[model samples]
Target: MNFKEHIRVIEDFPQQGIRFKDITTLLKNGQMYKAAIDELREKVKHLEIDLIAGPEARGFVVGAPLAYALDVGFIPIRKSGKLPGETIEADYNLEYGKDKLAMHKDAILPGQKVLIADDLLATGGTIQTSIDLIKQLGGEVIGSAFMIELMSLNGRDKLPSELEIITLMQY
Candidate 1:
């Protein structure tokens, strides 16, 4: 679908010397949005996923629809204190600051297969922390998927070797 073409590259966004790949441009277009979800769905069709877990905000945009397409339950890995129940939390470092992610305490069943989805894979800290939260709750991370990945960041190196990662576009 040439998803990369739909992404807007902004120079020095929110900081200096950083080029941000924005997906909102593609997200706002219905055709491109549908194509993206379809592509992501096709890539993970072979995986035996019991749940689709997405990080907060943007992750929810792609994750929820992907879960429906795959006919699996959706789990939300949200920012700290966002979940309205007993929750599990993980703290991690971001490029500018530290942040935490939380999930419902009973979100995943023991030994359930989970596929983590997010809009972009940057430093891998957020996704990696989500993976840890899923494991701590006894779920097995089958793979991780994203619409875009910043390859230069080398985020994949921080993840488990056995975990499969699929991305539609790389920048």
Candidate 2:
């Protein structure tokens, strides 16, 4: 689908020497956005996923549509305190520092299979933490999907060897 053409690479965004691949350019185009989700959905459809778990805000953008397309529930893994009721949390390291993500204590049930989705995969900290949170609740992480992956960061290497990550484009 020539997905890379839809992406915009901004030099030194939010920091120096960082080339950020912005998906908003692609997201603004309905055809491109749908194509991305369709591709991601197709990749994960064969997996036994009872729910789609999206991390934070961007994840919602990608994961919600996938969950809808697959007729599965979408669970949002948000920043700490964003979700009401009892919650479980995981702390993960980022390039500069650390951050925490949380999910409702009951968001995932024992033995439930979850597919994690996000807009991009950089260092894999976010998705890895999402996997930990899901597993803490007894949910099995079956697979993961992303619209873009920053391969230079070697993010895929940080993920568990058993996981299959499907990305629409890489840079």
**Residues 103-131, candidate 1, lDDT per residue (tens digit)?**
99999999999999999998989889999
Error of 1 at 154 (Å): 0.3
- TM match of model 1 to true structure: 0.97
Against the true structure, whose lDDT is highest?
1
- Residues 1-171, model 2: lDDT tens digits: 899999999988868888888889999999989988998888889998899999998999999999999999999999998998899999998654688999999898899999999999999999999999999999999899999888888999999999989898888
Clashing pairs for model 1 are: none
Estimate candidate 2's alpha-carbon lDDT, on a 0 to 1 scale. 0.92
Ten residues in a row with the worst lDDT in model 2? Answer: 90-99
Q: Give the RMSD in angstroms, all C-alphas superposed, for model 2.
A: 0.9
